[model samples]
Target: MPEFAEEAEVTADAKRAVRVAVLARRRASTADQRATAAARVQAELVALVRRLRPRLVAAYVPVGTEPGGPDLPGVLAGALPAGARLLLPVLRDDLDLDWGAWTGPENLVAAGRGMREPAGPRLGMTAVAGAELVVVPAVAVDRRGLRLGRGGGSYDRALVRVPADTLTVVPLHDGELVDRLPAAPHDRAVRAVVTPTDGLRTLNGKPGVVPHTSAGRTGGQ
Candidate 1:
């Protein structure tokens, strides 16, 4: 067997194991615990937008057992600048993502794989390039900003269009921020992380500067 092939198999197995563990822990949490985490996370998310004041923000609807929940689009819109836009992912048949405006949860439709997507016009993949902030959904993020996703290559493809220093962020449950994760050559590094407890952190280890928000903090490596 090729050396890299063996390593690839190991990485795939490790990624699957991590996803199973995270989903199981999320499923085990009580309704109240989940609700509390959601509220705190929502607040921090709003703070991120308000502080950065980005013209366009790329975000996602949290699927089942994901930390943020379905109403995340509303939270993002609430903090947007008067004319700013929130772009949601529209999954393409090829597993790449198209973009759409976040009208509301009511405007969402049931998409394949138990996901919800905006019903607005398809804005094409290049729309992601307009985003000054990109909030990706990840199973976890290591200190180096390597994100473990739910086995889909959508975000990995999307990240390729994102400009360097675009303030990409991954929102994870507190325990999901770890020291390291399996990385592939195509993996993208996020500039920051947000959690229910830790607020926001710059993966670079510098104190993240978010204006008008005291919730930002540097988390453990």
Candidate 2:
């Protein structure tokens, strides 16, 4: 195989290994643990939205054992400034993410991959570019901010449209933040990460302390 092909194979193998390990740990977590993790993530996200006050924010609903929990969309909806809109992803047939307005959790419909998505008009793939803050899902993220996604490449493709100045973040379970992960040439580096135990940490800067919010409770019910 060519050197480039060999490198791609190695990176793919590394990503698979990390994804399996991280997902196993997530599945082993108890219900109580998942709930606690969700609350912490909600707190950090609320603080971020309040501080940034982005006119348009993009986020996803947490499915299965993913870090932010099932009600994450609603939590973000409650946190946004009045008139600011929250955009949720609509997974296309080719695994590309299209954007849609998040009315509330009640408006979400079942979609492919056991995910819940907003039942609204599609805003096209480039819609993500308009978001000042974009929060993506990750099986794991490294200290350098390279995210190991679930192998779908959906967010990877969606991220390409994000402007250079936009803040892209990934939410993770406490242990999912690691020293390193394999990075391919096409992989995008996110600016920051939020974890259940660690609050928020910017890869290229000092860790930020986000105050815990009672606001995390707003749409949690």
Candidate 3:
């Protein structure tokens, strides 16, 4: 698919912003600063989880170069309901990912490209098609719901099979939410945004509006 020129510009700017933020985060002189940011981000993630309750959640385990810190594991550990089945992505040789269940932190093992993946049985791409919510990691997101992902385009391919109404979301630090993003035809638009301090914001319309419908389950085109 041809890339969207406007989307590309939005993505480039978003990447620049996130790269700067990551650098600043890495340069914090004191342990306290790093700890504080982690705690704040965790709190925001917990709030987002609460607001998205009862939905089958598909979230990622952070990798070395990913923007979100180690907070994701801890947030998933504490926030997910007992009855809720947590799903994680498993990258294949082709750079596409398949879904699997995460029993707990121990269920994750080191995978190719230095990523941590669930040890659970492969649940196939169709599993993603069934999810009610999918929390994706992005380099940046614009007001129109365009998300700039890491260059691999793995999520874009994986998401093509997901139900259209699924409450797809991308979580970033506060400033990662921007006015616009670079979009491509293959790039998917998420329904919401979750930030370290903002909880969850519906992005299909107003910035702060919370979406009321249960995440939709229509498979990707």
Candidate 4:
């Protein structure tokens, strides 16, 4: 097991490095290329969300204009059902995010790091703990369920607070998913992954397929 873990870590690091290089090149390309890729990625995210239809999903809003793909707002608008209440992470002063419901794009306000957030009432830690599904952002991820985050550890901290039964997923571009990722003891593995091509599936560290139904559209689907 220790050997396997070590190998997984090395593989994860290599995967992250490759993805970083790819994204850097993508960002440096012509404006038209970036726009076209963003559109494609956005369409993929929408399809995945529609198929999964998670209840009580926790997702993040994008900051800056790096041009990775469509931002979270577009993904939410395209994928979420009309009555489905989408949750956005509101970055607090202390570097923690307060989960809030997004009624629409107009409900968002500029928050920490210039990320857009829901203006709804702040849901306490308990509300976050009770979520049915959590959609995480990643710099990159591997087939082994290891994710490379933005180094803030905010998502890691918040993830630890969520119930074990909640389906944790990381959505990334197709090329971002690779064979492995460096894992730490404190790092948490998501239950599944959603990519531009792949809709959803169980991750390496977990078992069974995550059920997809629109029933828990409010909080616990």
Best by TM-score: 1
TM-score leaderboard ranking: 1, 2, 3, 4
lDDT of 1 by residue, 1-221 (tens): 99999999999998899889988898898888877887778788887788788889999998776887668888889999999999999999999999999998889998977779999899999999989889898988898888998888988999999997687888788799888888878888887778888877777564443343545553434
Tens digit per residue, CA lDDT, model 2, 83-108: 99999999899999998999987789
* Backbone N/Cα/C clashes per model: 0, 0, 10, 3
How well does candidate 3 score on lDDT at residue 66?
Answer: 47
Prediction RMSDs, each to the true structure:
1.7, 4.4, 6.2, 6.2
Off by over 4 Å in 1: 206-212, 216-221
Span of ten consecutive residues with least summed lDDT in model 3:
212-221
* Alpha carbon lDDT at 13, candidate 3: 81
Candidate 2, residue 103: the lDDT equals 91
Q: For residues 106-153, what per-residue lDDT tens digits would candidate 4 score against the true structure? A: 787887665788898998755677665677877677777777776566
Q: Mind sharing the TM-score for model 3?
A: 0.75
